[model samples]
Target: MHEFDLIRQIDSFAADHDDVKVGIGDDAAVTSSNAYKDMISCVDTICEGIHFKRSTLHLSDIGYKALAVNLSDIAAMGGTPRYYLVSLGIPAEWDQEEILEIYRGMNDLAKRYGVILIGGDTVSAQNGLMISVTVLGEIETNRSLLRNSARVGDIVFASGTLGASRGGLDLLLSQGLTAHRTEEEKALVIVHQRPDPQVTLGELLKESGFRIALNDISDGLSSEIWELAEASNVCICLEEEKIPISADAIKLFGKQSAYEYALNGGEDFQLVGTVAKTHWPTIQSTAKEKGIRLSAIGSVEHEGDSQVFMQKNGERTRIKRTGYRHG
Candidate 1:
């Protein structure tokens, strides 16, 4: 079958919506946007050996993650994801069944998030399977989150637990799946394989009309904090004791490494944001009502020369670059 044939097969699974002016089979997809809302778009890719190992991760998981990561981007911007374009580089060796399974995974997530598959390109790959997803979203212009909005004296907060994904990856790489491993270990591995984007939490923050700064933790917490501080022209102080470390990470990587994973390990997909000191109480209360685990990790300041630091036991240590980076 030709590339277009395969694309048509995938398109058969997509849902049609009124917002999509043009969808698959066109040269490019067109989506309608609200006049008052700003559009947000981001792209994320997953490769065969680079992003995942076929031996460790299932094809469905790879498909889910390809879309999930882009969802995380929209969440970071406090936007609603509406449409996506998926470009696939598929090797000849991949069978039709495998391809359908991948689309099924993506469709399940898309249905849950109310997103539609608009259109995309496909090509034959000489090497391995690759999926690049471009997601489009929208949010009220005034409520859009920005990396450079953290102000001095703002309280830093992290959504949900951290380090589980990184720890899970490490465990899978080192030990593989074994009968000796406990259920906690298996759960850690699942975290690495499937990450949930915090879209609801981001929407809540935007709707609440609180002045806040937001970024998703695709990179490690340390790297993300540095990015937020540098972009906002402020310094951030993270309390070591305040950082959320998951029990699974501690079980897999031990205490010290668990803390390191929380601070520097990447791909957690959690939300890290800052709120003004005065608004922290209300926002925190609302998050509690929503059953979201929002934890205060630090505070922002304008006095330091450094971008970020970890303070513990009355000692402050400057944190350097400590997350994954593409070459």
Candidate 2:
């Protein structure tokens, strides 16, 4: 491990890398500000034990998800991610290819979102592997959505389907999918490893006078909706029948597992947005125009005890858990 932590040395207030023209002493590096529309900044961390397991995943997947998670945050805020800053903590004895493989993953996502990895710092970790990324995005200021902007009477929408990630992870672990045997489960494995951040859809919402109470389903649908309700000071009533669970996901995992996985699972990385009920058609058309599917699953109700209700078969039941809470 490197004796001096570069990030730690920069932690001193006097050492703030302000001259660099962007974020310095933070989780992921960032730029000063976005030139176009509104600027959004978000950073996410993936660790060996918590966010991911190196042995359980390939080097490429570990690299891709490390940055994809941050991009997902930008999408949740309804912004167009333009740049990324990456930091890596590696073991001293690790092979040189480790770094390249990680970049391969990050670059794979950056290519899809049209973002660039502007800069970052690297250092030796005393123990396990760690990767952090910060992404900066642009959006129209007035249209830039946030979690707190959710409003009562607004419709809750999710981009594309959900639950494939959780299902994929389960299959990989339960079946011990090796690099050789995973081809049969390629789609399942891909969902868990290389999740697509809904940037286009998020940008569409930002430009179309939509985008209120934005959040990405990184944790789970129920969890994100609960957060939106808390931020907007409202209650979200989700229709179970309306929640868009993907058919491929159901085929990979059974109905109950898939439904719960979609509801309370993590890492789906879908965009969840709120908007006026009347604008449903526009959202749909816009999503289609952008090549994403937007599904309306619920509505925001007047402020009360924060809770999410799942309605099925004309019966509404309180969902005991809202979403995942990271320790």
The regions of model 2 sitting more than 4 angstroms off are 1-36, 179-184, 321-327
- Give every collision pair in model 1: none
Clashes of each: 0, 1
- TM-score per model over all chains: 0.86, 0.85
**Tens digits of per-residue lDDT for model 1, 86-127:** 998999887889887777778878888899999878788999
Q: What are the RMSD figures for all models against the true structure? A: 8.7, 6.1
Candidate 1 regions off by >4 Å? 1-34, 177-181, 303-306, 324-327
lDDT of each: 0.80, 0.75
Q: Which candidate is the best by TM-score?
A: 1
Once model 2 is optimally superposed onto the true structure by TM-score, how far is the C-alpha of residue 198 displaced, in angstroms?
0.5
lDDT, model 1: 0.80
Q: For model 2, how does the per-residue alpha-carbon lDDT over 130-157 read when each residue is reduced to its tens digit?
A: 9988788766544556676777788988
